[model samples]
Target: MKVHFIAIGGSAMHNLAIALHKKGFEVTGSDDVLFEPSASRLGKYGILPAQTGWLPEKITPQLDAVILGMHARVDNPELLKAQELGIKIYSYPDYIYEQSKDKNRVVIGGSHGKTTITSMILHALQQAGKNFDYLVGAQLEGFDTMVKLTQEAPVIIIEGDEYLASPIDRRPKFHIYKADVGVISGIAWDHINVFPTFDNYIDQFRIFAETIQPGGELIYSETDEVLKTMVDGLSVDVNKLPYSLPEYTIYNGITSVLYSGKSYPLQIFGQHNLLNMEAARLVCQNLGIGQADFYTYLQTFKGAARRLEVVGKNDNATIFKDFAHSPSKLTATIQAVKSQFPNRPLIACIELHTFSSLNKEFLDEYAGTMDAADEAIVFIDRKTFGQKKIEPYPAEVVKNAFANERLLFFNEPALLLNHLEQLNIANSNLLMMSSGNFGGINLIELKNILL
Candidate 1:
């Protein structure tokens, strides 16, 4: 098969392009701009475009398919050419769904926890020597790519994102999969720029649940009241499985899962992660894995990248960085770090980088989100407001929105770094949470300072 990708510089798009190349398909791709990792990786595979801009010549009648990335604009030149030639242009998710239509699709969806739950299931399956294709959002330690496609894998595990499928196709990505087995981790309003309203945001998940193949299983987190209600309203024909946080105890900053009067050590922790584990366990069981086998294999699992990732640690201090900008994610991450290190004073700093997080109205949703931390710090760049064309928020406004008297806010990364450096690291934990790098703050340098 000869395939070309529009906007191939995207994280998922580039990975999919590489996956297709490895599958022996004649792969070609184009993009307006390419960033570091994507450019380097694509170059390593000898597929990076010689020039950085899109070329209409890349899209031809001879092309078998053109996979469109969500980053591609509707008026993209290559896309326009493909449409003119009447070529089959599949959105990234659309292409994935088309490829796995005949297979049993296990889609892990929700506003959060999808990546972790999907990673957990994938790790377990790999450990059990089970062969399956998968598409997870974050790069797992043992996984070669975020996406894997094969003609022979009977089941395809998808980390179903609620974001739009493509520029032209505005439907949520998960809805495209038409899952045979579905999981909703939890629902919290996010991506305000896309959904606009909370009701509209939630309706997407409803569509996901209703779209599941008949007699298919729906595994979800019971701890989430919103998810529980949504699942309760689903048709009785759909198999419903609810999960909660597994039994566990934290001792001296290490969390262990308690099962059958025995405490099994775990590489991951947190109530949210514990809940994620239960959902993963149920899904794996549905996929023919027993409870004992799942637990046995999970012991060796570390975690997905940037999801409560430990960057540096010493005898008295540990620092973590997490991809947590949404309100629920921010709360869960802080709570996780604090739960694991109850005795340590946690200094949790989160960057307001995403469009949703930068909105004035959405700021109130973070009220008390950082209450779990011993010292909560928030960072937002003034330049971000300029780039986003949103009104600049004063630290007072942020502090008021959070409703935390002790919460400190910084508009500058250097000042934030200075404040953090002044902190006494003895018996203290630092957690930097953001979907971005906080104006390109060097975490490795920060870790070096801590050490």
Candidate 2:
């Protein structure tokens, strides 16, 4: 098959393109611009575009299909050309479903923890030598790409995101997967620009739950009241399996899970991760992985990239970075680090990089979220406002929105770093959280200073 991608430089799109190329399909793609990792990975596979920018002439009818990306606008020239020629177009998830409809699809869904849960399942499956394909949000240690599609794998594990599929397809991506085994870790309102309202945002998950394949199993977090009430109230034909936080102990900064009277020590620790581990264990059970084997493989499951990932650590101090900016994620991450090591002084700093995180209305959602941190700091790079085309607000506005008088705010990277340098870091843990680069602040370099 011959596939051409429009706006192929996207994080998900590039991975799918590479997967198809590896699957023996003749793949070609175009993008307005490309960046590191995506650009270099595509170039290595001999699929990078000759030049940046759309070329409508490349969208000939000879192409078997055009995979559209959310990065491309509806009026994109290549898209218009494909439409004019009557060539079939597919959002990546739509095509992925078309390819995997015959296989067992296990989709992990939630506002948070889906990536970690999906990564855990993949790690276990890989260790057990199970034949499976997967699509996880973050890069894993053993995985080369975020997406994998194959003709022989009997099952496909998907991290089902509730975001728009493409510029033309407004339907949440999860609604298209029609999961045979669905997992909802939890739900917290996010994507302020997309949903506009909390109720509207949650309605997407409701729709997702209703779409699970008939007779399939739904493994959800029973601890999450919203999910528990929603899943139980539904009258779907699938088996409703509920899971909560498992029995675990944190000793000397190491966590161990007690199951069947046996203790399984783990390399990762956190309340949310323990919950995610339970969700993953249930999914692996559905896939025929025995109970003992599940815990055995889980011991080696470190975690996904940027999800409480350690950047630097020493005997006394630890420096971590995470991709957490939403209200619930920020709260959970801060609380997790604090609860794990109650004795250690934690300096939790976050950068409001996303449009939702910086929006005035959404800022209020984060009230008291970071109170668990011994010292809470917020950073919003002044230039980020102009780059995102959003109006800038003062540091006082942020401090007031968080409703914490002790919160320190910074609009400059130097000031933030300088503040870190001033803190007494003997036996302290520093957690720097953001979805962006913290305004080009080199965190590893900062880790050097703190540790």
Candidate 3:
């Protein structure tokens, strides 16, 4: 098969391109601008474009299909050429569905826990010696690529994202999967730039429920009231399985799950992760894996990358970097770190980097979300405001929006780092949370300084 990717230097797009290349397909891609990891990885695979910009001439009739990335504009030259040639075009998610249509698709969806749930399922399936293909968002410990497609695998585990599929296809990525078994971990309003309204954002999940194949099942988090309410109103014929945080105990900063007269220690902690584990377990059960087998495999699961990952630690201090930019994710991550090390003071720092996080209207949603930390800090790069074409908010506005009297906000990275360096972190835990880099702050350097 021959496949060409437009704007292929994206995180997911590059991974998909590599997966296809490894699958014995002739892969070619073009991107106007390629970043560090993607550029290097693609070069290693020998699939990197000769030049950086799109060449419409590369879109030929001989091409089997064009995989479009969200990074590409609607008027992208290569895309226009492909359309002119009457060639089939597939969005990243659409192409994934095309490959997995014949297989039992287990899609892990929701605003927050999709990556963790998908990673958990992959870990358990690998441990059970199950042959399966998977597409997880984050890089896992054992996985080389975020996407895999093979003809022999009977099932495909997909970390279903609710974001728009492509520039042309505005539908959420998960909507195209038509999952055989789906899991909604939780629903919080996000992607305000795309969905615009909270109700509009939620309707996407409702559509996802309706997209499940006949006789399929939906595993949901019962603890999330909004998700539970949505599940209750689901008119789909598929069976609904609800899961919550399992029985667990934390001892000396380690968490363990008690099940079936056995105690299984977990490398991952936090109520949110436990809920994710339960959802993954139910999905595994539906896939024919027993409860015992699931627990046994889950013990070795460290966690998905950047989802509360411990980057550095010492006897008295630990530093964690998490991909938590939204309100709910920030709250959960902060609370998790605080709960795990109750004796240690917590310094929670978050970057308001996302479009929603930077928007003045959405700022109020973060109120009290960082209350678990002894010290709460918010960082928003002033340059980001200009890049996003949004008005820069005052530090006082952010402080007021969070409603935390002790909250400190910084529009400059140096000042933020200075404040952090001046802190007495000697018996404290530092949790740095953001979907973006903390304004080019090297986490490793920060960790070394704190530790």
Q: Give one digit per residue, the lDDT tens place, for model 2 in 1-451.
A: 9999998898999999999999999999999989989999999999999999999999988999999999999999999999999999999999999889999999989999989999999999999999999898888999999999999999999999999999999999999999999999998988878999988987888888889999999899898888888887898889999988888888988899998999999988889999999999999999999878999999998889999999998898888899998988999999889888889999999999998898888898999998889899999999999988989998788988999999999999888878887777779899999999877888787777767
lDDT for each of the candidates? 0.90, 0.91, 0.92
RMSD of 2: 1.1
Clashes of 1: 0
Q: What global local distance difference test value does model 3 have?
A: 0.92
lDDT assessment of candidate 2: 0.91
TM values, all candidates: 0.98, 0.98, 0.99
Q: For candidate 3, give the lDDT of residue 400.
A: 91
Native RMSD of candidate 3 (Å) = 0.9
Q: Per-residue alpha-carbon lDDT of model 3 for 1-451, expressed as tens digits?
A: 9999999899999999998999999999999999978999999999999999989999999999999999899999999999999999999999999998999999989999889999999999999999999998898998888899999999999999999999999999999999999999899999999999999998999999999999999999889899888889888889999998899999999999999999999999999999999999999999899998899999999999999999998889888999999999998988888788989999899999989899999999999998888989999998999999999878789989999989988999899888877777789988998888888989898777777
> Candidates ranked by TM-score, best first?
3, 2, 1
Candidate 2 segments whose C-alpha is farther than 4 A from its true place: none
